[model samples]
Target: MTIHLAVDDSVAVLTLEHGRGNTLDTATCRELVLKLEEAADGAKAAVLTGSGDMFSAGVDLLSIDAGGAAYVREFLPALSDALLAVFGFPHPLVAAVNGHAIAGGMVLAAGCDHRVAAAGPGRVGVTELLVGVPFPLAATEILRCAYGTNPLAALMYSGATLTIDDALARGLVDEVAAPEEVLGRARELAARLGELPAEAFAHTKAQLRQPYHERIAENRASDDVHVDRMWRSAESLANVKSYVDRVLKR
Candidate 1:
């Protein structure tokens, strides 16, 4: 399966295993939404994580470059939906960031109620500005909600990817654990959070994210067109190509 699903007691574990970096193409993005919906329906809490050396590298640039404008039109909306599903999930959700989480990956991790990063050499941050891509409306709100206005602005402007320690200090992650213990630590955190009265937790989460939801709902149509425009723009395409070239060289 492109997305692996399992249940450990009451916690649903969703592990991304599509390929190196666990990049989210249109298919994976859509699958993620379905998986989360299923988990939310059946599980008390959920843990989202990655296998091997990447939490995720973010959107699949190669896929976008290959598919062009038509694909961008399809993918951006799916991306927004996937992110909203995670950001607005009612029950306690934890991100077990095992490795690098760049751009959209960072946004996904940040959306969770609690973020736990593995100790060692993983880097995490929002680098969309560096890629010459703008955030979708829902994503912008998620970042604002996750990091507040100032820090989100700083992170985006600098396009800096930070070490686990820095990510912890910056509130990108709630805690840091040994590489071997990242998933375990996340599960522990999830279990504790799950102990809260279910209705109260769900109600409070809705209250916290309601503003973002409303904002996204208001601008989704315009945001969809704007993101598609950005994705197909010459500057953004060039930047994506350059990034792909650099990664290929390594």
Candidate 2:
């Protein structure tokens, strides 16, 4: 029930209400795809945010443990494809992060054209390396664009957690505002976008994203190799098991 679709005039808001952390998993991804399909047609702009204090815990670490690398290789991209649909949608997409965003959540937020966060929220960054799995090609491309030629490879490799202020400084978070103002700000920006000629904005956005999407298509060829390595890596196995153990410990 976390992925609720709220529409008002030309704006559509998809919110994550899943538990405290708002961690997205396979089911959430599927639900999101369905919601987006149903809600996106008449909307001028879309805003994505999480309920409560956490944007998302990223990928479901527990799912990885339950099925091993096979789960990641086979299913994670399917979920991301849903997110990518939003990323590549003709209209503007805004990320209104109400709380923390990590790993896959970071990628989802980054996928948007503009990213805004709550000033008092926890943090946002990719921590995939800490868990021993490589980030997906789409995420890599998004981060590379956000971080530039000097991508935050080390952050991904080291699983560093960036604060809201630091995320802004690092160019990861576009703007930070009070928690209550997050959605309003996104809607405000969406209005700005709506005022512009829709065709022009859509064309410009598509032109900017084409190169990145093409690059991911190129990576698709080698993606299988990345998948195979995880399936065989002891580190990947150990990381998944550890994450699973966290749930058990609770």
Candidate 3:
């Protein structure tokens, strides 16, 4: 399974475990949505983390290169769906960013109600532009909701990863913890948040997120068509290949 779900008291801990980096491929994205639905049914709050030292390396670029345009047509929607599921979740969702959270991974963390990163070598940021792709509409809206337009624009434009200190300073992460304590800290936060009156908490969350949801609903169809086209274009595919060769070395 790409995601493993475990319940600790009223808190559901969802750990991403697809491949070494927990990259968000089509299958993983679909599974994330399903697991989150299940979490909503069974848990009061949730904590999302990744196995080992990588929260997620982001989208499965190698898979994209191999699958080509046909796969891009399929993957983009699934990726957006997964992001929306996390962003719109009724219960409080905490991100335990144990390691590198780049591109889509960073978006997932931003979708969470609160974020805590492991204090060490792991970096966090949005790198979609560096890979020569535009943000899917849902992703852009989610980042805008979390960081506001100006900071979101700066992060998207630069595609630069930041240290935990920088991430905390920039408000990307709410707290920092030792590598081994990241999960514990996240679970603690989740449990505390779970203690709130469920209906009230859920309602408040929905109210706060309603604006972004409306924006996503209004613009996603047309924006995604353009995003899909760009992702499938020959130029973007070439850029993906170059990124893999030079940065991923795979």
Q: Pick the candidate with the highest TM-score.
A: 3
List TM-scores for all candidates, in order. Answer: 0.97, 0.91, 0.98
Candidate achieving higher TM-score, 1 or 2? 1
- Each model's lDDT comes to 0.88, 0.77, 0.94
lDDT of 2 by residue, 1-250 (tens): 6598988878888898765577767778778777777666868888888888778778777666777766766666666576677667778778898889988788788888788899974788787776667766776777776677555866776688889999998888899999999989998887677677889998998888888889877776587467657744778789778756865347
User: Lowest lDDT 10-mer window, candidate 1?
Assistant: 241-250
- Clash pairs, model 3 backbone: none
Between candidates 2 and 3, which one is better according to lDDT?
A: 3
lDDT of 1 at 216: 92
Q: Report RMSD (Å) for each prediction in the order shown.
A: 1.1, 2.1, 0.8
* Runs in model 2 lying further than 4 Å from the true structure: 228-234, 246-250
| Native-to-model Cα distance after best TM-score fit, residue 75 in candidate 1, in Å | 0.6
lDDT of 3: 0.94
